[model samples]
Target: MEDNGNSTACCVKLADALMSMACMDLQLQSSIHLCASDNRLVPGKPLSPGSTIISDDGTFALGFFSPSNPKKHYYVGIWYNNIPKFTVVWVANRAAPITVPSSAVFTLTRSSNLTLSDGNGHVLWTTMAKSRISISSPRNTKNISTEAMLDNTGNLILRSLADNAIIWQSFDHPTDTLLPGMNLRLSHNTHPLQRLISWKDIRDPSPGPFSYGADPNNLLQRFIWHGSVPHRRSPVWNNYLLIGKYMNNLNSTIYMAINHDSDEVYMSFGMPTGPFSVLIRMKITYLGKSNISAWTTLYSEPVHDCNIYGYCGPNSYCDNTDAVPACKCLDGFEPREEERRTNNRSFLLGCRRRKALRCHHGNSFLTYPSMKVPDNFIYIHKRSFDECMVECRSNCSCVAYAYSNISSGIIDDTRCLLWTGELIDMEKGTMDGDKEIAVKRLGKGSAQGVVEFKNEMLQEIQRLTGQQGSR
Candidate 1:
């Protein structure tokens, strides 16, 4: 509580306190010392008494504080000093709270780990992922870069001058909110992938339902999973061939950007030219929805309806910015039921054509403009628009095809995406994407051929994956 009581102009005193805390633990008595907040965050060991960890901009301070009752217990967390609110992004001791408020000390153990322990010698918190493998800075970084800092991007990092690159960050091990630069990948990197797990309760920082990330099995799309089944799914990347249509919309400009660095690929959206810039964030809601939001003068609404996953039924789409509701059936098709009303409503039983593809004769494609493609598709790289079409059509089972050039300064000039089978969850977009697609329409005969083709193709897929087909 007295950490912030000192004068504003004071310095070096806090630095001294940090160095003094290192003496509490025998293992850290030597290498543990303090570095000022300039380029380096003052550090001793994580929980040494008198030592305080501050963010680079001083927007947040990391130190010991009690969660609710400060007089009886102490917790190590990061919070804002300027606001009337105590916004703790991370808490080092969430499960264990010191009872006696005994003289607490945080030190790097002989095992090369930073740990928080009671003055009576009780370990409460630690930074080691696994206790079996002793923590080591092979380069002896902690002795070099010296301080662990919370950077401006909300990343708490440990760096050494020897290798300035980030060694550890809280982003990689998310507690609740997904911060920028965090890759929520599958722990197994295979089928039955995981998603971003939320917290158990509002205050309790434990894993909850509603994890979000790309579906490894159906990777052309991102999904929010409630345990195992898909709670919600993003517009499948269906050859989402280059949807980069950067337009100068008033002040804030929205452009999709993608890049690769060190074998990791990521994409981020930006509004580079905005006045009094505000936070534009996206999150997988607890109720299972992907929301893209920006801080308006007063309230925030879905920037576009297409932002919601599965707003329209399969082979149908949401066309926001239109006078009517954003739902529209894909071209060359109509709702299957005779009782179908031409209005915006959410329903599955996707559109069916008056012109049935009987697989008896001609097959043609009806092109749609400014459309957010469908889900349940595959990615076929290095294929031209025509090549992609042929790949789907020759199979006879291939139902539809959507191709994007991706050459609009984002992806390969010749990169193509191909789709087969039923088209689901599509919507018309503000931008027509960079190119168009050709959907093959089958006559009654061709339709029958497609059904047979699909059966045989399913067999090959099962064989390839070494899965037994149903008897």
Candidate 2:
């Protein structure tokens, strides 16, 4: 486990001369200076654009790197140093990229502030002192010693020489990826929720529309939002020490945990440390897919396009049990007017009721099994099966109802979810729980010929629904 925000409060004490000693050891062994591996930037020894500082374990590196094309623009960032391919984790000046690489200089000022500036002394980025500390005027403090070091965990920290007082750190300002030992704040009590914003594209490190973080409106659930709309969602957090433990292709287990205390509530996931842990990263790709991958078998969530939020439009259910996941109309429903053509290949417009329900004529519930409940549902509580059924039955506006005793919580043990409007973002075979939904529809007796066709269609639906449940 790791601490939050100011990590030094609980950080393991390391000697101030740790970086010097490490550099000295390397010099003695290799007799190299310019290309030597020294994990710190001491005052007066400004780090140029070409040079880089590697973590003690050499697992990560901090230096200037360019995305898209190396000659175009350069940004100071931390990346996996040992990996064959350049995989950056965090960027210092994301919006501001230095065009001329030769003019870039990363140095520590007399005030112990780490600054990334150009040859003309134009400050691109800086880790300035907090409010309490004063650095109003620059002074030649020959006696003062300050240095910046890259820790083994890939965290870049700037500390004072007298005492290891952490002035700033990279973990406090995360970019896209949530590395191991990273704390993602889930509440705004102490600070705003920490979110992971995806890169604009493979070539651009700028911020994109996709972001993953705690839902402010509802603290219980986490969402992957594309702009303002949710793309994928995680089940409500129940303050579990361990929510899920998934095994990767490399046979390593990744665990997700919900941790909290008096001050903060947050979620973080990590794999086992030591040699067993391989290089892995959880990222939301530019195309809006959340993925967890190691060197081996990494998979993306919402695997099918049908699983995407409302991809099949309103009143349509995505069937993933089939050879190919697709959308289809529910029973007693047909495609909407303009989309009713037999030649229509896409179900983008979805479906509408074949015969509008008449409350006076009486309607019946058509149970659909193995379902991922539709969005925009009202979660009603403390209701039995009969009570839940009546709750929807009494209301003419209620289109569907789903009852489940899925939660162990005291408040909403029996979930009686009711849907009033058009059902969107519905899918089958992807639900963790095999919950069935009963849709309210017009009930009418069919003739002999129509009865045979209806029975056959019902049998096929049951088969597919059964597969969804089993999946």
Candidate 3:
């Protein structure tokens, strides 16, 4: 046990050398594989709860986060990393959340799939819906190396290193917000129509009743639907470069682009570029309204509830130009239930025909200019003014018709739209729209009908257009 000074120094050097060699061996082992996060994971290396991967630009981060009721469920999601608020944009286990957070692990499996599993190996969620990688047989394992990246634009991509191909992307499947570069496809050859559905509530990310997308039957127009019912419709696209542009509350320009080809027809939004930093998103709100919101302020498409579908009921039109938004009856119509009329003369019971129509008698058409056309229209192409008039005149069921000479890009340029059945969700004084509708009504003295006016405004409007001629 006794040692000289020189011998003791030599022993210390030997110990130091061994320690250095072990540290070098550890560093080499770490360099063998690449990880998505700083504490990256390779095959068999999983991310337990509370771990995360941040984007290179630090704009977004992917991690496991819980909602308001943390004990109920936990989700693997992506959110804005730089913002003060935790705004989640993408969710991995949206439909099936992990009920037990402490027992969950998010991992890239040996089969090159991103999966979430419990401690007992119960698979909770996975990106295996369209995986192209091959699974290993009994003796051999697949060595396909994959990496997860959160791109600067907030896209989470699982990429294969072998051939540099993306296995899956978060942009393809959106929950609520429609980012700038994401495409909202109206029609696709192989896939169903793509849309953005709102969340169930502020505390829950479940799919809500509100949805925003293109009209499936007519791809030219976009619509916001409330549980399969059309709520609000966008103006038909003019086939121009910019479909619509608005200066958001944050003083940034947000514009939408329309693409139409033989394969697909889609729309995508764009934010202001160059020097300015801003993010804009189009979202369907839980209350069934489509809103384009920025970081600072939110702007709604249909500003008033009267603009919503069927708010004013059938045969009546919502008038938003007035100081107080109100509904008005068409010429020669009265309130369906006159007893429900208030002292201020507001018609809560919609409208009904003042004079009942006889199919055998001759009827006249009344023209109303600058109006938002009603819903449930039948489109007929290649029709002139006289032909459109005859088309409606020939059928006793045709109640109204509107004509528009759309630009060439649409399916039919010379468009004639006719409406039958109940005329629900109409609007008057729509300055942005430039179409006129001709409605059929019985001629004066043709039936035992009495005209009743609830208010002076409606009575004055009836007097001004009562003499309108019909062909």
All candidates' lDDT scores?
0.49, 0.67, 0.64
TM-score of structure candidate 3: 0.74
> Per-residue error at 260 for model 2, in Å?
3.0
Pairing residues by index, what is the TM-score of model 1?
A: 0.63
Predict model 2's lDDT versus the native. 0.67
C-alpha displacement of 417 in model 1, angstroms?
A: 3.1
lDDT of 1 by residue, 321-375 (tens): 5766556666667776732764436545666665655452267555554455666
Clash-forming residue pairs, model 2? none
Ranking by lDDT: 2, 3, 1
Worst 10 residues of 2 by lDDT: 1-10
lDDT of 3 by residue, 1-471 (tens): 111111001111112211222111101101112123542344565677645676665555677666644246677887655443457777778777777777888887767778898778899888884665654531232554666667767787778777889888778888888876777778889978888988887666778888999888886567888888888876544333332334543345566666676788778886656222324567787777777754444568677777777777788888877997888888988777662456533455678887776664366677766577777789888986557766876788988887654443635756677888778777887533434677888864332221121132234334433422220
Q: Which RMSD values do the candidates have, in order?
A: 11.8, 9.7, 13.9
lDDT of 2 by residue, 289-369 (tens): 877755433667778677777777788888888897878888888888877765543478888988787774256677776
Backbone clashes per model, in order? 25, 0, 0
The clash number for model 1 is 25
